[model samples]
Target chain A: MQQRTILSTIEGHAAADPARVFCRFQTGAGTEAIGYADLLRRAEGFAGAFAAAGIGRQDTVIVILQHRPELLYGFFGAMRLGAVPAFMPFPSPKQDHALFWSSHRKLLALTGIRFILTYRAIAAGIDEHFTGLDVRVLYVEDILEGLAAGTVPPAPPAPAIAPEDVAFLQHSSGTTGLKKGVMLSHAAVLRQIDRYAGVLGFGPGDVVVSWLPLYHDMGLISCLMMTAVTGAELVCMDAFEWVRRPTMLLDAIEQHRGTFAYLPNFAFLHIARAARPGQRWDLGSLRALVNCSEPCKPQSFDAFLAAFGDCGIGRGTLQVCYAMAENVFAVSQTTPGQPVASLDLDVEALESEARIVPAAPGRDSRQVLSCGRPLPGAEVRILDGAGGDAAPDLAGQIAIRTDCLFTGYNHLPELTAEKLVDGWYRTGDLGFLHAGELYVLGRQDDLMIVYGRNYYAHNIEEVVTACDGIAPGRVVAFAVESRQMGTREAVVLLEPDGTREAAELRRAVKARVFDVLGLTLQHVEVVPRNSLVKSTAGKISRDQNRRRYMEERAGNG
Target chain B: MADEESFREVAQAIGETLMVDPATITRATTADDVNGWDSVTHSMLVMEIERRLGIQLPMDKVFDLADVGELVDLVAAARSAG
Candidate 1:
């Protein structure tokens, strides 16, 4: 028997269990069921269309479709022909069309991407504003219609693929120009599924319900690939729809008897707040609501349980997983039936001394949630400031070595070399180990997580500094803890150049940030020049400015 | 209150939640007209309206609301039904 890739595994499952439901995709109208056989056939139809349009093996195909069935088909179809497929987010309605399309020029040029699978409206937008790139835009509507009318030729035979071949690319979360494509191999993905699913006891008969976007690793690998490779069922809905009406998840879990779900900390809060008081549903089918992608805050889980405890949610039902795209998904996951561990540390000691000391009497304490133990083939180390492994219970930069680590960051050799050193990937997260479990203590880098998405503070700063009336190099962006919201909120402080009114400059900065990065800054403060603090390196210090901002806010309050 | 009054209240709630000018909002105002009025703030707006009006809007219908006018109508319908 040969080592199986994701394509081969899915094909095998389709042949063995043709009638099994692989995906129950819910649109705004209703749910559409696609069985294993149907999925394979539809994916092959897309493959045929791509073949007719000159997309061949190793060609990078960027799928920019909305959260529709074609998104799934286009992704797998490219893989079927041994072509590389990477999912990019469709431009939001609020985003500027010209900026969104133009931002992809560098990425497409670097990767030599010639084919973009998208819908009609996006294709028209690309044709009008996106220039200087000779790229072919293949519309999903036309292709599907052509396949139905028998106008397109049949798909060629499946190309031979090794397990080590690149399967797909997961673009990291950031502004468009700064996004790094993390290339994952077929073998690594399959290996991660085996280890991760084994830990969660996931297999056939388990329905994984999700409303996460397919562009990210948590959605692509955990829910989509895991179900496909393991022959389990997936109940998916559009992420935007879920955000507006979160109770749809409850209804789906009840209707489908869904056993598992992956959610970020903020979603737990969103759903809890959205549910009607005293209303109940039969959510007893859920075994684990795994908190992932964002930091696992115990308070968020508590709020969720307070809302749905009568619906069979409990402390044990809430698990936590520390995951990232570079690891191909899960580095550690709590056992399904076990309560997540937590530690209350003295805030002063932990913040000032970089030590994980237990809270003393009458001291301010911070409750840190445990990310459970590492998976079977993963190792975790805490690197001290001097680059050596730190002692247990000391907070430092986290590093991990996993069997499912990504091949490299596509087209960025320097970054790949800097991050991956001697088989250990230096994750910029700060954490400590206690009793064989990892306790994450925020980030060492300026990356912030808001509403389950990662945004670099430096990216926000860059966007802010480019706006008019802002002093260049006098802007700093950072995240502040928002306990009421159950997630971090981004704050930006910039010194103005006296060219525009403060209120006008503030509004312009907000609009520019929203238009560029699709993120709404929680607060923007325009101050006089020289108001910002600088580091010893003579650069605007984000950390020092953040501390000053917090102090000023507290003083005023 | 009449539909006009209800519409004013809806716009007020939207402005407060999204930090926009309430006077700028109108019956035909959709999410596209306001910056920072994406999915997350939409939910926040729903909750804010529910809190301010002391009524529970139907979750299914709230998700499909097209404009501020639809929201105003939904709140009225829920109030009458309640």
Candidate 2:
């Protein structure tokens, strides 16, 4: 499909149906909505205000704000003026604002953001982070005020946009710490929107209900951008609000007759657990409830069906998508209305035999959920550790080659070169292909998934080593498989510097990590100074430490 | 709790779930007062209390309980009504 600009699509839909509701969102007041015509007006008003603020066509603006209508107006308006919008999440509750500010400073210095769009209160909170930056702040309230006051330059000339022009920068890590902007061109995003949306059978008639954070790729591209491009109705809520009121999501879906939504695995469990007795929602209106951004748990599907099946949710409604910011949005998604195919793998075969064999009904079966086939124009392959193609049913590193692939990392060329080989991007994910469907296992790298958030082992180690009693450069953090939670649990094993009590050391380490990263440690083992093993080069080995810990636990059992 | 005496028992269970010091937790303790008391843990805490007390606090009214005292009263009310 030949596509040039994102605005053209939005404009086309607006021209066709000016009165059609484009999106709906919750505010402190209550539920509010904007029609296509109103959206075009607000977006244009934002672009005009941006132009009045002297924002140039090729500028990069970091759009950080709470989940609100201004998020769209600012983002789309920036794009309208041919400025690239890089979305970052707001300073969420419980988040370490100082760390966020420091990292964002590093990122802004690297990317050279020309402008920032955010609230005054949010700006004040992180004002020190951008203390001396040349970047100008574009407050949301100021823009709205300008529009209201009729001071914004009306009808700012829309810049000539090219398909090859950078559309936006996206970060892969959902929960946020390190910021690596994956630069995507308009062509790539357009291709992704067409192909991914087509396969999912998204049309103007379908309404989207989501509480996924706007900074997240799954929420940004799959839900907001796609729905906007298609002129489909969207019912939205902020991530912070959703965390407090998850059932409100179902309430919106039932109230709006929402046909589609997507969430991570942990959310499925959250919703199921949050359900009150006798509370019912019309979930049957949903044609597909895509599980993505994290490993899709087969058991969560069972739990969801058991909890909400009475609401008319079908077996096929729960689907899985293997996606990343590097690929614009989705590499693959299960066919809508088809039960996500799963395999009960033999655990012994998974290790000893190195083959994925069908599990026997007895003791050692691992139920693995299939993430499904590649989207049109996308190619997925399993590569063994040696870089050669892996045999079917053999788990290996997942890689993708697609037209929608990002150009490269924003400022880290070496990092981009490390992951993108030839044309195929090494996903750092491990999975196997079976029956033309992909079953994602976990990350091949030491990236740990805890409570559905990605945290690198190296980063965790950095935090652990900085603790009071922990020895520097003698820390190892890894994830142990947590069968009960349907995801891995992060565990840390570090050498104490002195004769401090182990329990105290553990508590201090855990508290420091929690304070810095909000990561709750499942296990914090303070081993003897030299108990942890090292490589021949004397570098601490996380894999070896993890193995030893597991063995000790097994022996105790 | 309506009995007021059951407040300590309820407070202890909530504190255990959130890994917070129960003594620090008062009738005005909100979810934000404790670390790790976000959505995931909050739901777990609510479910745990429901299971332990054999009372069903209205999920819709969950946000109404600003602290341990209000939560106790709500739980106790639900129990007595049931």
**Of the true interface contacts, what fraction does each candidate have?**
0.23, 0.17
TM-score for the A-chain in each candidate structure: 0.97, 0.92
Model 1 regions lying over 4 Å from their true place: A128-130, B1-38, B51-82
Q: What are the models' TM-scores? A: 0.93, 0.88
DockQ per candidate, 2 decimals: 0.27, 0.23
Clashing pairs in 1: none
> How well is each residue in A260-293 modelled by candidate 1, as lDDT tens digits?
9999888898888878767789999999999998
For model 2, residues A114-163, the per-residue Cα lDDT tens digits are 68898876555667677888768888988888889998887567778889
**On a 0 to 100 scale, what is the lDDT of residue A101 in model 2?**
59
Which run of 10 residues does model 2 chain B get worst, by summed lDDT? B30-39
Report the Cα lDDT for residue A123, model 2: 57
| Model 2 docking tier (incorrect/acceptable/medium/high) | incorrect
